[model samples]
Target: MRQQIVEAREKAAKDGIRVQRARTPAPDVAAPVGEVTEATEPFQDNGTLRTISARYDLTGQRELLWIANEGKKVGDARCTQKFQFSNNTTPRERPTMLLCWRTSQDKSVVVLAVTPEGRPDTRDAVAKLDTRWSAMG
Candidate 1:
């Protein structure tokens, strides 16, 4: 656990990502499980990373959906997960922390699912990130 945190911090530094901790409490709608580490950086895609912290229960389902929406908003690519949320269903929360960026050269969106301890799950992070790349098309 400690190793993961250290690694993530090191990667962030190497990538030149400056982690930005929130100064104030986020709204209930934006953050229900309590906000975790929120960080963003300018990268290759010309898209700024927007990571919304979630909790342990989060499966990143909604975050994927949100990313799709963002792609649509930015006039780039749209997310492929097309299931619409019903009014009665409360979407699952996202990971406590999300690390997002683009390939330094290709500008592909990279999404990493972070662990509760605030460390990114490096093993599967890039794979999960690849799933969202389809939306880039």
Candidate 2:
């Protein structure tokens, strides 16, 4: 997956697509949850524009960035959106594409359950988020 991130960014650059990433502050190792340092990996994805080092909780899922394909500037159009592949996945399938973006001040992970355009399936999942990342509010 990490290798894919690297390759994807390279590809995006060649295609003139912007990419981004972000990560939360690292925990103290014994901070209850798990090591969060791995969340700060470098952005070597081949086709990325802006790589943000952040994390998001979708529903109850601790989402991680596996790939960031493209990015659109905030308020440049409607939303601060980017194409991404999330590490969180079900037992039935692999990590899929999602719209990891901001709608207000909160960032969110819009899971693409089954939209021909790959839209977020759970509306409330994004609504519950505090960061500016959402689709339809």
Error of 1 at 128 (Å): 11
Task: Indicate the worst ten consecutive residues by lDDT in candidate 2.
Answer: 35-44
User: What is the per-residue lDDT of model 2 for residues 11-119, given as tens digits with 9 covering 90 to 100?
Assistant: 9999997664443323532222322211121112221112121233222223323323333332321121242232333222222223333321333333222232433
Instruction: Give candidate 2's total backbone clashes.
Output: 40
Summarize candidate 1's per-residue lDDT along 1-137 as a digit string, tens digits: 99998899899989998654422322343423533334454423333333433333232333433332232221232222222234334334343444443332223453534344443443344444454554434
lDDT scores in order: 0.40, 0.32
Off by over 4 Å in 2: 1-62, 76-97, 102-114, 117-137
After superposition, the stretches of candidate 1 with alpha carbons farther than 4 Å from their true spots are: 1-32, 52-55, 60-137
Best candidate, TM-score: 1
- True-vs-predicted CA distance for residue 59, candidate 1, Å: 2.3
Sliding window of 10 residues with minimal summed lDDT for model 1:
72-81
TM-score of each: 0.25, 0.22
TM-score of 1: 0.25
**Number of clashes found in candidate 1:** 1
